[model samples]
Target: MKFFQIRALAASVLLAGGLAAAHAQPAQPARTAVRGTIDQVSPTSVEVTARNGTKSTIALPADVRVAAVSIAKLTDIKPDSYVGTAAVPQADGTLKALEVHVFAASLRGMGEGFRPWEGADGKKGSMTNGTVGSVVTTSGTTMKVKYKEGEKTVVVPPDVPVVYLEPGDATLMKVGAPALIFAQKGDGGALKALNVIIGKDGTIPPM
Candidate 1:
């Protein structure tokens, strides 16, 4: 199967803290992601069924962004791999890992900074992106990551999910395909596509 990747290639925005409300200024090249199943598709529009069972119809522009998704593994992590993780700060000031995402080498500079991350529980945590210097396996696992300004220790528990992205293109656009559509609203009160991330061969996009 062929692959297509959505590369966030904008300039890095270094915040004072984790991706937080404090750094809530709007970005210039803003990108939006809509994760759902494709229900309908045409040259000008698309209909999607969201994960929660809601459906929405969006305009598909000529220059819509399209990418492909693939599966990855935890053992694929190694030294020099650029990765990011949402971490909860421990009482001892270290970081307890919540979720980890590995990036392809093409994304070396994408979001290459740390900031406060909004947790599922309404509390904000931390998000750090850096190259993995080493992985320590003792009780569970530990990833020592180094960024431009500093370093962080990420504690990878036994059951924490780990995955990576792959390079994908726009050819995978089809009905019944699982996709993450990144789009924005136009002046006419309609959602327009920016990025359409698709999965191949009966595979649902897990990212």
Candidate 2:
């Protein structure tokens, strides 16, 4: 698949307690992506264990939102279809796809823009949201999507994970269920989930 070579801003990560001094330096943005199993959950927070064995606790604000993501196919992308692609910049100035997600029509205008993704591990990449203007299908798929800012070209390799979101309930956070969350480590060192993607049944979200 082919991808657009979208421009990017500098990527930085912020840690708690990095600005205690009067002469402190600039603080980085709090963007993170976490994928793991639900170790525990409560009214105030949830504990998750990463596949690599890293564990984190994230505070659940009163209005925490959740969604369910399911696998999609490359053919799922079509002209005028709303989608978002997360990809890393290649040395050749191309956006090499990390993953591709087709959006349900109801989410047409949600988080619609291209910018540095505050993904888990400070995902250093761009996320473009728009309607696919065209699709080139050969070995892989190349897509041209037009957003408010402009257009982006995204290449979707066959191996890239593709998913779409559906309404998810809090009960989807069953213990031992697979999940992924884009959150930020708050000042107190506990992560705060801004959005959550919970897997259904035994299916784990792959983006």
Candidate 3:
């Protein structure tokens, strides 16, 4: 009986020791992808700037390919938009890329008119005796569409509704096509057309 008790206590001690060792073991570190944009390039090493603007220098490898993104291809993004930088790594763990794109914007004007402008809600509306005008430009949320009728160029403020058609991109728009346009009365009365529709394609439908 004495020997059996001793053996049991020893087994318990060993089990406890094993449990303690297992609990004390270090956890495996999380794996993350090495991604960043290049900032500068050199023969031996490249410098990459991170999204947070931190710069890292990486060594170059013989088998790595270096490439640059075309300015024309980046059309969707505005000019001078910041792209994240990164350093390329070689097989031997050597850094190569001087700059990389952690984040990049498309070049300006490449995707123009592809994205609809604000206020393009597909609601039906109307305008009464609205004058025509050239769009001088847009400011804030208002667009100044100007047109010349007879001797006077009438400036009309059209409330831009949800864009049924984007600017510079004409898609199947015809005169008398159902469209909603904002209009102002001569007495400065302003209201949104909720039901009356107009032909955007150019030919006015018979009244």
Best candidate according to TM-score: 2
Candidate 3 C-alpha lDDT tens digits along 63-152:
332222211112221223322211223465332222112112232222121111111122122211112122232331111111222212
Sort by lDDT, best first: 2, 1, 3
lDDT of 2 at 109: 73
Total clashing pairs for each candidate? 13, 12, 41
State the lDDT of candidate 2 residue by residue for 1-207, as single tens digits. Answer: 222122222335644444566665667646667778899999878899987799998888878888887767899999998887777777766677777778788777766778776454445777777889999999899888789988877888887777776767687887998888778776767689878888666556744
Better of 1 and 2 by lDDT: 2
Q: Which regions of candidate 3 are displaced past 4 Å?
A: 1-40, 71-207
Give the per-residue lDDT digits (tens) of candidate 1, residues 30-96. Answer: 3445667888888888899876698888888887756555555566668899987777888877798
* C-alpha RMSD (angstroms) for model 3: 33.6
On a 0 to 100 scale, what is the lDDT of residue 31 in model 1?
43
Model 1 lDDT, full chain set: 0.69
| lDDT: worst 10-residue window of model 2 | 1-10
